[model samples]
Target: APLMEIDPRSPVPKYAQLREILLDWIEESRLGVDDAVPSERELGLTYGLSRMTVRQTLDQLVDEGKLYRVPGKGTFVARPKIEMSLRLASFTEDMRARGFEPGSQDLARRVAPASGHLARVLGVAPGDPIHHLERLRTADGEPMAVERSNIPLALAPELDRHSLAGRSLYRLLEQEYNLLLDSGEQTIEAGLCDATDAKHLGLTAGSAVLLLQRRSYANGTCVELAISTYRADRYQLHSTLDARR
Candidate 1:
């Protein structure tokens, strides 16, 4: 069925009415990825709304990742986000399972002291050895996320001996170190890309992003602390809900 016409006489706010109408346009393919949305002035005129109201509606959708704003290029329809299922799986494995080729580019790798927050999260003492690994992870040659991971080096000594470039960290832990991943806890939040992340992800500074902080465990012992920033326009999180009586 066609979407209901925006009711100017109804009790519902005009901004909401316009927001839903535009969303329907996106779903119906009247607008597609990279397609520019109407200018605030044009939309305001079309809907008989003030520019402030039009801007407000657009801003909300931009924050929701339904639209993206380019510095001088105006707002455009965003690409569909890739749904990341809530499960304990490495990026390489997850991509492969989804039929996408996974790859990584090592940005930096070094050894550092696990102090403060890092020490607390990994259950290690202050000044304990930690491996700081940063990489730009990709699927099908498209950059997806930048992961900065810190590992307690005492638990996996000589971890720096192996080359992790474009390789799965979990696979290395299991196949070489004999450490099996048992569980992980993660949280997701909406954020804006910083200069560093924006440059790596091919987005402008302040573009929408999904920030993930995760702790992975091996046999109930803390093993890794990872902070990953994903392009919000191209990534999403999905979870299944159990129906209750």
Candidate 2:
């Protein structure tokens, strides 16, 4: 079905009415994430409004995270956010559980000496060998998070030999190194994208994002400390608390 036309006589202002109609189209698939949104002039003309009105409508949507604009390119509909459970799970497993195809692109990976904070987090001696891996994780071909994980090399010796290009780090630890993800302490926070993160996660610099830091334990020992950044518009954390035991 076509979207409802703007009602000139409605109590709502014309810009607000147009904004709602466009948002409804985005929600109902009348306007997909593809580059099909009409030009500002075109949209104004279509709705019998001025270009300023259309611009304001788009600007509001952009701020609300309903849309994103490219510097020289036009704006496009923002992808729907993926609400995920707060339970500990590998990125790959989480995405798969949500019926999305999970993928990872390794940005940087190597074994390095664990320094002050890294050593403390991994519960290892300073200067101990540590496996550092950085990768951009995606769900259904859309970038989701950039995970930077640091693990003590003593726990997973020769781990660098394996090709983790598309594999789950947790799965690899379990199967190859006998490291179990027994428990984890994770925290949630908010931040704006930095230059590096913006490039990897496909967001403009300073875009609002969700920040997560996790310290995972295996067999009563710290196994890894990972920091993950997710697009605020593409991920929502979900958790439940109950007294039943």
Candidate 3:
């Protein structure tokens, strides 16, 4: 349908009709990543819409990650979001499975005394030594997430000696240390990216992000506590629902 086909007599509001038209264009590949969207004035004139309505439609699209704005340039289509399944897999494995080259930049790795909260989470005594590892996770050389992990030193006493660059921690524990990672529990929530994390992710402070906290188990023992912050604009979580569950 043409951009000027918005119907005034139909039950749908003008703004919604315009929104659907734009979405159709995107979904049908009429608009592609980095493709400049029609200017607000152009769209308004073509569709006989007010500037307010056109701007509102564009703003909603931007918030939905269908479009992005450049400071001096106009709005453009955004890259397609990566749909991530809520599966118990390492970031390295997940990205590789998705056809993206996975890489990690070790930001911090040190032995630290477990705090009260960390003690309970990692099944360690308070003040016990634990390995704290922070890394910048990347996909295809693009910053994707920030992962902070805590592992009880008792589980992997020589963890520090291992080379972790672009390696899967889960795989290292399984292959190098002969530990079987059988299960995990993960909780996810929406949050604003902190300045420190945002800088690592190449996003402005307070940008939307997905916070995932996971506890991985080996032989029924909690082995690692990891908190990951993912760029919301580039990733989305997917899950399958079953009535039996």
The candidate maximizing lDDT is 3
TM-scores vs. true structure, each candidate = 0.79, 0.80, 0.96
lDDT of 3 by residue, 1-245 (tens): 54448898989988888899988889889998899999999999989999899999999999999899997899999998999768788888889999999999999999999999999998889999999999999999999999999999988989999989989998999987777778999998999999999999999999999999999898899999999899999998777778995
Q: What is the lDDT of residue 213 in candidate 2?
A: 90
Q: What lDDT would each prediction earn against the true structure?
A: 0.89, 0.88, 0.91
lDDT of 1: 0.89
| Cα misplacement distance, residue 232 of candidate 1 (Å) | 3.7
In model 2, which runs have C-alpha deviations exceeding 4 angstroms?
1-14, 42-49, 70-75, 140-142, 238-245
Largest TM-score belongs to which candidate? 3
lDDT tens readout by residue for model 2, 39-82: 89899888999999999999999888788787678888876668
Residues 21-91, candidate 1, lDDT per residue (tens digit)? 89998999999889999999999877788999899899999988889888888999988788985798999
Taking all chains together, the TM-score of candidate 2 against the true structure is: 0.80
Error of 1 at 180 (Å): 1.5
